[model samples]
Target: MRRAVATVLASTLLFAAAGCGGDDSGSATDGGPDKFKVGAIPIVDVAPLHLGIAKGFFSEQGMEIEVVNTTGGAAAVPGVVSGDFTFAFGNVTSLIVAKSQNLPLKAVAEGNSSTGQDGKDFGGVVVPKDSPITSAKDLAGKQVAVNNLKNIGDTTVRASVRKAGGDPAGVKFVEMPFPDMPAAIANHRVDAAWIVEPFFTTAKNQGAKVIASNFVDAAPDLTVAVYFTSEKVLKEKADLVKRFTAAIEKSLQYATDHPDEARAVLSKYTKIDAGVAEKMTLPAWPQKVNTASVQTIADQMQADGLIKDKFDVAQVLP
Candidate 1:
């Protein structure tokens, strides 16, 4: 697995290094890094990062963070490969797919994880109150809106359907932003939505029925997403990567220890209603990156034909 992933990394790094063109912005600092950019979406998974910033965790490492809000991992990848971001938050599926395509990425820290409970996980598939899709099995032949197509959203949603004895490949997936999904479901533009917290809670509040906690169905305590950087940055800025990893681990631990603080920090970075943020199911932020769950996602990606390579999750780990 390591060889397979490393082989792809080697191919991408050669291409990425050629594109660098001597830009030291990724690692030009003589002293401990002062400020670096991290591309992330304003989702509940990233609340730990916001809380850490507010709590001075990164600053404690003699570093500062400038979080660049992205639509999703799809956007985060290019931003990092192009040197627009030193690091980015993305799912195991995205990073693994990026690896198969030789995108030169590496995971540095655990981003967020599933609650590992049915009906209680932070992400799920939801249908409007009057919809007939009462269970994951009912999703067969249905149109589902996901924040991104061919990524974590659909793969996990497929897992949920498969677990419920339904044909996973029969579901039709459509791409729509998380923020736009609730309205789309209510209007019947999509039969259901694979969404996460804020929207998950928001959809439920709007009388949507939760048919499945897809992340939980995919894997127990699944490591849904992670913080990552390009291989070029990993090699050139080893110090930055080390410090950032330490800080992120500390931030994740702190968030796990303080749920109230994590929930409160969401208001600072997202437009989620305070009430919804307060009551939303929070994902686990393990101090240690969960590589096992990541492997599960990698297998899902291959099973779903999202990756054509024998990618190893370990090659991307810090």
Candidate 2:
């Protein structure tokens, strides 16, 4: 059985939230029953959550967490807003867009923040090893595959291309899932693919080289991934939020301190090779959500016309 340690404050938060009639609750403040449900995606960036579960961090916090795997951020947000899950992980852009649309969601904690080290910004445009395209400039009039059009992969690629003195709109963007990116490249169906996670590693293993990483051209502190909860959940279950955040922080500390152990845990959940998990660059663990970092993403989304209105970062953060 996994063992977890909880902070006194977090325990209090859980009780307070539960007492307010949040959901079905049989748990006590001191490790009695399962209480909250957390939804997540399979992306490697959510390593800390997997690590926390493996290490029993949430269990120690007196919370029973239900982990649900969804397609991506687009699907996760609605579940969070509808109270299907108490919390969910999503891209910062998605959160900002939701906020602009007056969704009841707010970010309670930072899930992951990118840095250039170890390919932390592991997303970029890549072509087959033998492709004639040599640079971002060469992508002109070429077809590029993005996991989702106008999403993180595509938006970052567009920014990078523009920074490289290439036309951002020169290349046509094709939508494809990360898992299918390699086949697309191999068939010459697309000149290059913008990808993240297991696909990035897989593509590299298959002789696809990156032309540029988003970190090279985009804002380094841009909010990439985060933990968000609905406003109703926040107002009624502040304690649960605190408990979750505390457990997550502990899990992150453990990951940073015991990388080998963390990688082992990640491999089981992500099915990523142990060696690949070890090689993948992960974002820094934040103690709480950073408002400024989130605002940067919101600003970018507005500029990209992904959101109709600018949202105040503070209002969106718990």
User: What CA RMSD would candidate 1 show?
Assistant: 4.0
- Once fitted onto the true fold, the runs of candidate 2 whose alpha carbons sit more than 4 angstroms away are 1-31, 117-120
User: lDDT per residue, candidate 1, 1-318, as tens digits?
Assistant: 353354455544644664752342344367765677889998899998988988998888878788989878866776677677778998887778777776778888889889888988888999988998888999889999988777899999999999999998889999899999888877888999999988889888888899998998998789888899888777877888888898998999999999999999998888889899878999988877777888888888888878876668888876
Q: Clash number for every model?
A: 0, 2
Q: Kindly provide the TM-score of model 1 when superposed on the true structure, using C-alpha atoms.
A: 0.91
Which 10-residue span in candidate 1 carries the lowest summed lDDT? 20-29
- The lDDT per prediction is 0.83, 0.69
Candidate 1 runs further than 4 Å off:
1-33
Q: What are the clashing pairs of model 1?
A: none
